[model samples]
Target chain A: MSNEVEETNSLKLVTPGHASSETEGRSVDAGPGDADCSPDGRVPYMMSQIQETLQTLDTAVDTILGKVEELHSKYEREGLAENPVLDACREITFACCFHDLCSQRLNIVLKSLEEFGDELTDGSNGTREEASILASVGESETRSATQDVQGGGSLLNGPAMTGEGLSQEDVDELLKSFEEFN
Target chain B: MAVDKNMPVLIVDDYSSMLRIIRNLLFELGFKNITEATDGREALKKLNRDAYGLIISDWNMEPMSGYDLLVAVRKDEQMKKTPFIMVTAESKVENVVAAREAGVDNYIIKPFNGATLKQKMKRVIGDF
Candidate 1:
């Protein structure tokens, strides 16, 4: 039941004053990308696969990290040396976070190149504006900027964040820079 | 040995996150020109299209893994000279020996940091 409410809220974030009824049948809401989505709002087959794979990988990382956290909590009172393992975990988290956001954005560029092969046949003339236009992909946060992900928020669950799309952490960070980006 | 920081480098891995992490480490070490491929087949495609100073690839992937890629690259006269570095989680001595026999220039174990990557890069393409 809570999933329904969370999903509904995710639909609400598509655009200010946009009608939720207009977005009813879409299985996923990709934030800004909704504006450009097909009427049925399905993601491209390849992009959906990529998003699914990335989400699985992110979940795997989260699972491992969670285990480490649990270990840390379990061992803290044992008086064993803890800094070495904790420090390594910190570094691993940093690397994982950086990799997650940076690669998702890079995949966007690669997908654009694949989809619009004719426009970029020459490869040299693709402009920043063209990239931005394509970046406004009609999917929920297929990815966020490195700036948005630095906080270790659980943004991978989907554009519907915590349970659905944007988590509170993700939404707050995104809102801080929303006006600047738009 | 000395190396050119600006030389084009090709990195291959099915996991985009692994690619991103390696690319960032290379970037930090002053190497800027980088291309990425998800499997050995795609890496070969890029190898055919352009010259790379080095190739760093993971060992496991669908349709093509880094070992097959290394053998193919070694067989190709044009790409045989390009330094190849294999990256993977496998630490078994036999795996390292297998990569070496296949003509890999170096090997990197997974969960590596910038220093380890830089050290591997030094062994293959020389110090940056």
Candidate 2:
């Protein structure tokens, strides 16, 4: 009976409890009362973080754009009409347009985050419904953008190529294919 | 009529960066007379103010898209015959078909370099 009591006590020591040394090192599964249960509070925090990151990106783009414009003006004033230099300037200017593209895409994300934050802070049953609706809207937008990139469904709905843009050879081949079809 | 490189050309896009890029490309192609508008509505207002020899426009814009602009241009008696090229990131066949049906002279996909732009312009307005 004493051995049985000792075994029971040992088992109790291993069981999860505030005072159990054994339980200290083991991670307990989170329950409804845990700090992680209400993640709604973190939504605004995450949104703010994203907003800050986007602002940084915007500032970087603006600085690059400003520098390019200044270089373009300098080139013009210097009467540097060298073809290669002019061509490089043009290419750099074209590349700078990526900031606009990024801004457009980021706007979509920011809008979605704002909607989600609003839903989270509402603290009503409608929060779930709103979240669901927002999620679906986001999903649909993503799917549509994907479809546009993939050239899925109608051939006329999206970009000609996915990431990295189309090569000159690819463009030529596409033109040929179109001509062949026509 | 053969394209006159100095003839006034109108470029339209909602993104100013895109407008600047297109203008630069046109400039590189030896097109000296170029005008820019931020969107289709602005393009229309400019269209009424001046006669453009050619119109190159981005398809996606708020309020009035390039398609709407094209339709409006086609409907107008004065601008009906102007060479119009629809530039868009979208390469969907449906959009191509619709633009074709709507009487677009040519289509150019985005991220196109000067060489590609030159070729497309040559096709639309004849070799510059």
Interface CA RMSD, all predictions: 18.1, 5.7
Best by TM-score: 2
lDDT for each residue of candidate 1 in B1-128, tens digit (9 for 90 to 100):
57878899999987766776677567646788999999888999999999999999987664677777888999999989899987765444445545666677777655456666777688677766
For residues A1-182, what per-residue lDDT tens digits would candidate 1 score against the true structure?
12222244345443422334443566343443434344223334335545666677777766765675566545554655456765564466446743444444546555664545433332336775565565456333543321123344321220111243223233224433543565
Query: Where does model 2 exceed 4 Å of error?
Result: A1-59, A73-80, A114-182
Model 2: DockQ vs. true structure: 0.28
| Alpha carbon deviation, residue B50, candidate 2 (Å) | 2.6
- Per-residue error for B32 in candidate 2, Å, reads 3.3
Least accurate 10 contiguous residues by lDDT in model 2 chain B: B90-99
- Give the per-residue lDDT of model 2 (tens digit) for A10-104: 23222112322233343332221222335564455455556666677767766766677677768877988684666677677767756655665
Model 1 — TM-score against the truth?
0.47
lDDT of 1 at A140: 33
DockQ of every model listed? 0.04, 0.28
Which residue pairs in candidate 2 have backbone atoms (N, alpha carbon, C) closer than 3 angstroms, thus clashing?
Answer: A155-B92, A155-B93, A156-B92, A156-B93, A156-B94, A157-B92, A158-B90, A158-B91, A158-B92, A159-B91
- Report fnat, model 2: 0.35
Distance (Å) between predicted and true CA of B117, model 1? Answer: 0.4
Model 1 gets an lDDT of 0.61
